[model samples]
Target: MIHAHLTEFHGLPVRYVDQEAGLTASQVAWRVQGDSYEEDEGTFADTFEQLLEWDDCDEVRALVVGTWGWAHNDDRADVPVRLLVEAAPRLPALEAIFLGDYVSEESEISWIGQADVTPLLTAYPRLKRLDVRGGDGLGLRPVVHTALETLRFESGGLPAAVVRAIGASSLPALRHLELWLGDEQYQGDSGPDDWAAILAGGGLPALTHLGLQDSVRQDDVAAAVATAPIVARLESLDLSMGVLTDAGAEALLSGQPLTHLKRLNLRHHYLSEEMAANVADGLRGVEVDLSDRQDPEDDWRYIEVSE
Candidate 1:
């Protein structure tokens, strides 16, 4: 099974509008090109036109988008990316954007196609957070942005190349980085070595939160992260939504002292009760989240967000 569609983004409730109306700064706007397979009725271009015409368009601070065309079948719809690139100048207060908000009913996480995202960062200097889903044709160029603070990618099968690119990129101000590396069934094939650059914390001086979630080989991540140099500076770590068993828990507990961290997320795991208890006892003061204990049948452990 997959996760639910986003109800909130960047800490704000999501709102979908169709007409000119007053909008608050506390909510983010959402638009999809088509719903129920309508061709020309609702579209990215049409919605953009409508959005620009709103009385309070300039007051909009955040936006969410998904499925520019034929969402369920189309793997690469580069039109929305181009549309956003062109619309950047008109959105004055836009600070955050979320791409690919569809759930399984619309498109699987791995089915959403993404384009090169370097241009968005270049265009919106004020943009602080960017959350993207789907990695099928996803492309990103190493960028240096001063204002960007949070970058996250959600995928059922994140590509190895994309993972390597993120590790190689230079994000000086990025404080939170999360990547959902699903199983190989979709396109996920990255290993611990692929993200070694990120683990080493080369250009990320402000990073305090790291999430290597939703992977099949979570044990490998745990083993490497336990001894990684980045852990020394991190305030929280998320190894959730993956097939983490007692072996992974043991590696984490034995490798480094996690008592300094403020949070450790190990939800939806296959760890034994004893190992789960050990994790809680090991990090006494930390806000350890060990919820969603799984009961795997025939020793088949599963991840949360893979198709």
Candidate 2:
């Protein structure tokens, strides 16, 4: 049966309305409420343990936990959070876990702040994707080594060190890496060279597609792409929203023979029709895109290459 709680409903009994009906594939949604419950500490611990020990618990495909309200300054909820983390190891068949703000109104405490979700990621092992936004400073560096295929960092400000760390690590199974740098503070200057070096050092060899949105410079973007040894293997290169000019694009496409590059996105730039035509002519097999900028009406004209 599906389970949903409108308040902080941990330690409550699982109400099976029809015991003999049997449980089908179900989803559980919990909402945290700011009400006090009777203190049955020992029973609560036992119940949590029982859930962890259940062998058939692997049938659970998805789990959603929502938190609302704030814990009193003197009242600590670390123990329960630790138990939740420990119980995560029992979910051997879970595919996805989403942690974010679902309610329209903001709560006094962050849901992630109350739960130890990072430990759960390490323990779960089979988790393929994780989406997290707006937490109490959860460190992603610790769990970057997971067998995750798709990882997205949205509304969170990642430091240059963290970005560099991801670039340095080995992620063979990783295919898609999306980093969204929303309005948050960054201290150090992490330019394109650092990103280029990271990609060159084998950070993302298996990555066939990459998207950079907001706060990325054109030269840095070009340098990063040009430096990557695997650029030749990429099927698509998207640099739609950056400071790319004719010079940057020329620098990127000049030396390399991007035979596999099928789609090139150079939108939102000041490239002229003549320059765009030149870039298009250079890549014989690729489709050049210079849309929504200065040169949108240029029909691609190619010159015959001499034998």
Candidate 3:
């Protein structure tokens, strides 16, 4: 498993590979395009080959896979997944991967195409962390892994079936889980009930950090999370970048005993300053983030990433 060293990248904490210390973190990075594909930079396969060529191959731990395409039209989903499959056998020390690093300018989070990621998990038994963006055609059927500790799926409109698959998975060592259930407007079909099932299920016995972020139905989610049995074991809870309002915050403040949490993120909300402060006060010792206050006049609410 990778021991991620915290480093700032584009204002966020990411993991950068450190050969000397055998430490790595996920950082902002982009793979070069294939030479035959109009851009003569480099292909994902080529970059991976370079990584394999290093003398300290056994020391490398983390990788942030990105694309060089300028627009949606230039994105090629097949090559990346194929190259990853080809490279997995040789990446013995690899433990963490952040697939699809494109931002809104390159492609919306929902627009980025993704292949089934189950094979990667099966190939690497030591893998501990996996972060995937874009949910189109994404599937992980009944995965039963041992070393996996953190799993994050950042998508706008995550399908209900995928949510069901996650709830049914057998990852006993998983400690962190985050799912961005976007608006139904973008194909996000998982409703409050789907989330309730995930929370109620005992699939992830080791889970502590939970993030149900970037949803149009955030208030409903917050209301559900307030009473979910999973909250009792969580050390961190993130419900940011959505339509969280005063009512939802009130549910959290009034219902759950958030004193055990180490961190609580409630950024990008529709809460008034008074309400934000009130919620912050409720979780006295917890590190709380209530930034990016939204005005009610902004009639329509949106998730951070949507196609």
Relative to the true structure, candidate 3 has a C-alpha RMSD (angstroms) of 5.0
Worst 10 residues of 2 by lDDT: 298-307
The list of candidate 2 runs beyond 4 A from truth reads 1-57, 62-84, 101-120, 134-138, 142-146, 181-189, 201-205, 266-281, 287-307
* Top TM-score prediction, candidate number: 1
Judging by lDDT against the true structure, name the best candidate: 1
Candidate 2: tens digits of C-alpha lDDT, residues 47-149: 4444444456655455433332233232233444465566675666665554543342333222224333456557666766655433344344434455766
RMSD in Å for model 1: 2.2
RMSD of each: 2.2, 11.0, 5.0
For residues 18-51, what per-residue lDDT tens digits would candidate 1 score against the true structure? 6324555435655544453764467677776777
Candidate 2 TM-score to native? 0.59
TM-score of each: 0.92, 0.59, 0.82
Candidate 3 clash figure, as a count: 5
lDDT of each: 0.81, 0.49, 0.73
> At residue 88, what lDDT does model 2 achieve?
71
Q: Model 3 compared with the native: what TM-score?
A: 0.82
